[model samples]
Target chain A: MSKYYSKEVMDRFMSPKYFGEMKDADAVGLVGNPRCGDEMEVYIKVREGKVESASFRTLGCAAAIATSDVVCEMITGKSLEEAVSITEKEMVDKLKDLPHVKVHCASLALEGVKEAVKKYEGK
Target chain B: MKKIYLDHAATTPVKESVIEEMQPFFSERFGNPSSVHRFGQEAVMAIDKARKKVAHFLGAKEREVGFTSSATEANNLSVLGAAGGGHVVTSSIEHSAVLNPCKMSSGSVTQVPVSSEGVLRVEDVLKEIRSDTTLVSVMYVNNEIGTVQPIAEIGKAIGEINKKRKKKILFHTDAVQAANYLSCDVSELSVDLLTLSGHKIYGPKGVGALYIREGVTVSPVMYGASHERGLHPGTENVPAIVGMGKAVEEIDFRKGEEVKRLRDKVIDEITSSISGVTLNGSREKRIPNNVNLAFEGVEGESLLISLDSEGIAVSTGSACASHSLSPSHVLLAIGLSDRMAHGSLRISLGNETTEEEVDHLISKLPPIIKRLREISGR
Candidate 1:
């Protein structure tokens, strides 16, 4: 049985959305290990104090990759301050419902936002 | 479509001869071996004959072999049955069956560390030994990393400590994976206690044996009617025990040589064809039927999925804990920096594996690793 990630999640992880980097960006941050179960990296482009462009790459379980994809969609046009507070529960909620084993992938999304906002503020 | 079975270490199909031998026990001649009736006598003689075969296989006295539900139970009886004392000595790479009981036991356990090669240094084990040390349990061969330990040498050292200190310390080994291909003679290995599971040797599950030298006293972990001389209780699975004995009888020490030849072919191909690869454990000391490796810049779960699609089966070291995605404790103890550990996979071969399957795996695997690494941009 497929325990952790669903077909939707697998598709997103296999062919991730907004997965590349940007030379012109307000913030860039990456968390997790490639050799580890999951890795999430975020790049944000801010325009007039709003997130104009957001991209991510997730080297993780199917849920982790899908959450990163959805998180990018969720954060676009939102203020950097608001984006940083995104929670894993909200991420899983966006995906309808993730498998019991992969709920932690949602938390990785939260960490990515938190770190990216930190990077954004430093600049 | 050709489907290759490379997971022999997990379990093997029951052989035809073993099945034939066990047929009568299930139907026409069914009887409790402990009963005094004619049917019971048939069961009793059969059980005794099988016991003798298993004992002869392990080069131990027939009376020393006590059959149990499984190797996991046998391991518990060995580790949890420790003489209350200083600490237990063991390797970090031991199977959870051994590690879990040791971890939960009241006796403090010092998990002797393993190098990147996954070999436990005798000196390191010796360093862990102390005046209050009650037992030293290490596997004859590692299940994940495939490393073969020097059980005899380790046992002898433990024996020397017993003589010097005039203590009753015991030496135990979980020889399940090792028993299929390795020489597991307890006398030659100088082990006071040993365990082997039936499933690992192509017999049915829930049946195994523990060899306790005539004088060694192990406190029974399970509370039941005094059975197996009070070591294990409840009705025995005569059919499975018979199968276990048959499996033991069928193991050809020469299979070790054949397995090594196949192992070299598969391992050489996979590591050579793939990039950013590392074979985990002691290369020289590993079992001939096992291979564990990590692909850098790849998630093991993802790789496993890709292989699953190709009809190839394997296991990643990390398993999801109850409601939590956690890496394997075995990998964590070996200190693989969390990430390196997740990308590891265990591919164990069986008696029926073929060179064609090895070639197919080698051809199919490199592309997947390359594609996954590239996609992840690592």
Candidate 2:
């Protein structure tokens, strides 16, 4: 029903994929917005120059939460460099659409993941 | 799963009786209340009846209540009109409707902070009052945390505080959230002006009233026609006013026993059923309908979306300001980290909500938290 995400994304949000974290993450990034009260912590497990696993703990709106779940699915098998390049537009496209109000939440999740990957690279 | 509505604190659906009562005003009694003909007389009679109904509801004299576009407008008028370039004192947690307007006006407000549990400190309010304080505007109930301010105590304080000062400081309350759950009588609350809205009480939107104590003068916010005694000026939305009155005319608040039973069931379920959770509002003093809880590991926004997928409709607080990137000011004021603020979910119950729906929510929420937490691996 929302314009920002697809039924597929909403379905993933409801019955999310790639949930749970690696027992030992190579690196973790915690980012928060003190103003709006939204926060996300992402964990990355790198192996053989690829992102073998991805997990997130998010304190945000539904869009941010569901988007994180979707991001995990999208990044799990990609190279660290590739995963870091993920965009909110890509997530929004995957969702088919999101409302204007929810777009920021999607962007936050993408940024949170990228920041986590950057943490892994010491950037 | 079938959907259930619980967020009545945000806004409620228009009742059928109110809808029926409003029909004639739109079609038949469409004349402006200011006209001087039979058509105008009919419209005038209707508005008078609606005004008297609103006044009677508040147990004030018939001429005291002035109709406005919404409770927000009434609050603006009361806060602005009463303080003519003089000082104002109000709560830090007032609905942005009151707080923002108060901030923009010529007068300044003290904005006394509430306790973490959201109780207004009576002493802090007293401390804020001074010789230059021309008006004291406090809300009867808080919208975000569902904390009820001691308006009666504040009223007593204002009464005593004003007796010593020569300015005759007026006392006003944004009583929009309190009308359904609390008493409507202004005398019992001991205030000079009170603001109320219809949509919050199952009436149509865009119609509200300000109960100004007789002989308590205030400058008009909108200037034009003599409608609403020049205090408010506009071609009245006759239908919405009728609907508002009808909504008040019928009082069907869910009972204390029922409210407690359902409130406790949901609180027990959310607190016990789900992990990584913390209730944001003060449980002891909160409105029975509101349940704002924070999940530590998972973001409230993400949880909100996941739950939405299960056909649930809830919110973090007021639906109006939910979209902003910043966390809730009220949450921040209570000492929550950005993490705690983002993880909050506000579940407000309604008349139609049943035990089964609550059980369904209880069943659905834990898995989402568990799944989200796992994804984070923290």
The models' CA-based lDDT, in order, is: 0.79, 0.78
User: What fraction of the reference interface contacts is present in each model, in order?
Assistant: 0.27, 0.71
lDDT digits (tens) for residues B1-378 of candidate 1:
566667677777888888888888898878888789998889888878888988998899999999999998899988987545447888887878888898778888988887767777888888888777888999898777778888888887877777778776788999988987888888789898899988888788879999999988788887888778887888878898888889889988777777788888878888887777878776799888888887787777778777766778776752222233566555666567667777778788877777788778888898888767755667
iRMSD, all candidates: 3.5, 3.3
State each candidate's chain A TM-score.
0.84, 0.84
**Best-fitting candidate, scored by lDDT:** 1
lDDT of 1 at A85: 73
lDDT for each residue of candidate 2 in B259-371, tens digit (9 for 90 to 100): 65787898888888766677776888776677788777666666766777677778775777676767777777777777677667788777667888888888888888887
Write down the C-alpha DockQ for each prediction: 0.32, 0.51
Which residue pairs come into collision in candidate 1?
A: B117-B281, B117-B282
lDDT of 1: 0.79
Instruction: Give the TM-score of each candidate.
Output: 0.89, 0.90
Candidate 2 lDDT score at position A75: 86
